[model samples]
Target: MKSQNIRLCFNNTVKALFISALLLFNTNLFAEDLEVTGNITQLGNDWLVVQGYTFYVDQNTELRGPNGSIVQFSFYQLNDLVQVKGNNRGDGTYLATRVKLEDVPNNSNEIELTGYVSAKGTNSFDINGTTFLVDANTIFRGRRGNPFSFDMIQVGMLLEVKALLQTNGDFLATRVKAEDDNHQHGNEVEVTGLIESKSTNSIIIGQWEFFVNSQTVILDRNNLLIGFSQLNVGDRVEVKAFKQLDNTFLAVRIKLEDNPQSQIEIKARIENIIGNDITV
Candidate 1:
């Protein structure tokens, strides 16, 4: 009779242990959340596919674009690169919690660009792969601070542009000024490139070197003054400098591109698997 009671007790203990294991598994399953960053390859009425993962969006999902403005699901378009924060439902379906649009290079409003004009149109032009639209309010100037007409703009000329970025990635020129690239004695020079490296007093953009002294002026996208400490590698910038006799560019003013904030997501990659452990 004692052995019989022991058997019954063992059975009950086994049942309790099994239930606890099952509960733990269920908790771990629902805990899998994921984030993704990639271009939208497919779109649907209620679902979208990015980087081979299908994510479902419902009323609870929050969507935003430039300036952190709330947007609808319909605002997303094909080929738009985006960052998504979501949860994995453990059944191959992802539930989106938030979606943020990433800005395309040279596609934002705050670019103070200097580039050679590639094409000239009646009311617009192409520079550095970006289109600049002009109107009556557009101000034009020459190398000597002289007023010029729109007709003076020609292809193959270097120009400096201060423009506002449009929602659709077009640039509306507030000011268009020509650069006298042929003037060998001209001390003024402008360039736009990603910062390769920097120090407290200098920075390297592409292959060209630039120096920033105490008198140098630096501004962010909002036109607010900033310091060299605020700059970082891989930041795109436009620099207006004076060409020194030694050929090094002395930065008189600098402008950094202020990209909009986007929700960032990344996929987890498993590097190795061992008996019951995984490396990611």
Candidate 2:
């Protein structure tokens, strides 16, 4: 009987040790540092959300700007690109130790785009072949400031978006405002061709001359935002403009085309396919 008690005590001690080790392992796992890079979606007195993850900030947290200069948390704005180093709290949130602001590339642009939704995804939407990513801080509104949600958006719906281009070539939308489909702008014109000539304020495509202004959004062949000064003569482009009361076409958006033809639809029966070649 004494030997039985000793065996029981030994088993109990082993069980306790196993449980202790497991708890330690889990603690270390949760203590691991995590790094996240994305645009700041939401900001609060002591917390910020990035890419749908909430991170708590405290006095110990270090905040730095793009130039590596110390900065205050208040300097950050919604949709500002950032990199965060933190520890997961095991409750779906994080405790940030470092928050650094990232600079927008020179090729990037802050643009206001108005168009029909061409595609939709869980966290993003496409307009005119350009993808716009959305996060918690992206404000959505209907006519007259009525509340709207991302789920309420649909393909073919007209929306006006204000967005910033990220270094990774994604457009992070800051605001999405729905517009009426029937609403039309007067004297809207769209032209596609090589740039015949260009000046400080205008570009010639075919026979139409489109005037560019500070508000004009220029994108490169990769659909990345650029400046009007980056445009060169003989480059292929597509220009969307509106005629002003002064009988001048004001370019609203200018996109560089990747190919001579934007799209080509071929309708033919496939006869055979070999390796990397297909005969139709």
Candidate 3:
């Protein structure tokens, strides 16, 4: 009977150790730093909502406006497209360490764009070779006065954008409306979508094919320079390209998106097969 009790105690101790290790593994995931980019949807007394995540700002949090100018927290207004670097409190709230506003054009110099919706980012979209920044104030409409949101927008759909042009050559969209142009021609365009297939010299994004050459530049999600060989199928990418005389897209630059939330790990499965000149 004494030996039975000792065995029970040993089993309970083993279970306790396993539970503690599991808790530590989960804690590490929540302790990692986080960065989010989106439009401010709500402004509370000491907190704000970006996309859907709520973040609180303390006195030590750094704030900056356009042109990298230091600014007070009150300077940020609703619908402002901003990036927040913060730490997760592990309870669905974030403690912001820094907030930086994106460069958006003032209410002047309206420009119009008509092309495919190549890609959609946190609070921005790319159309017709230009990146258009959006905020809550930016209107989104469908054909014939229908309502739409950024989540409804997809790759390969035709869209018309009316925006203000910034001095730095980017655009700040005031309105984005959809268009039905099944027969419209592809012009100089920017596209963002998943890479359906890829080769050493080219890739297919959505319904468009982009060809790369020596002059084509490749960048990672952080805008760091990389090589074409680093790309793979199923990667989400954005491409700036020009339509050539032969109707083929000549890629000028390609940017790969490295979203931390999308990070995943997998194990490779080895297949037993023999090639023409080798055996496995």
lDDT of 2 at 20: 10
Clashing pairs in 2: none
TM-score between model 1 and native: 0.29
After superposition, candidate 2 runs with Cα above 4 Å error:
1-158, 161-184, 261-280
lDDT of each: 0.64, 0.67, 0.64
Q: What is the descending lDDT order?
A: 2, 1, 3
Of models 2 and 3, which has the larger TM-score?
A: 2
Model 1 Cα lDDT, one tens digit per residue, 41-118: 999988888656678898988898977789889999998878776654324456787887887533323435555565
Models 1 onward score TM values of: 0.29, 0.34, 0.32
Number of the top lDDT candidate? 2
lDDT value, residue 98 of candidate 2: 87
What are the per-residue Cα lDDT tens digits for candidate 2 across 184-218? Answer: 23244556777878898999865578887654667
Sorted on TM-score, highest at the top, how do the candidates line up?
2, 3, 1
Model 1 C-alpha lDDT versus the unseen true structure: 0.64
Most TM-score-accurate candidate:
2
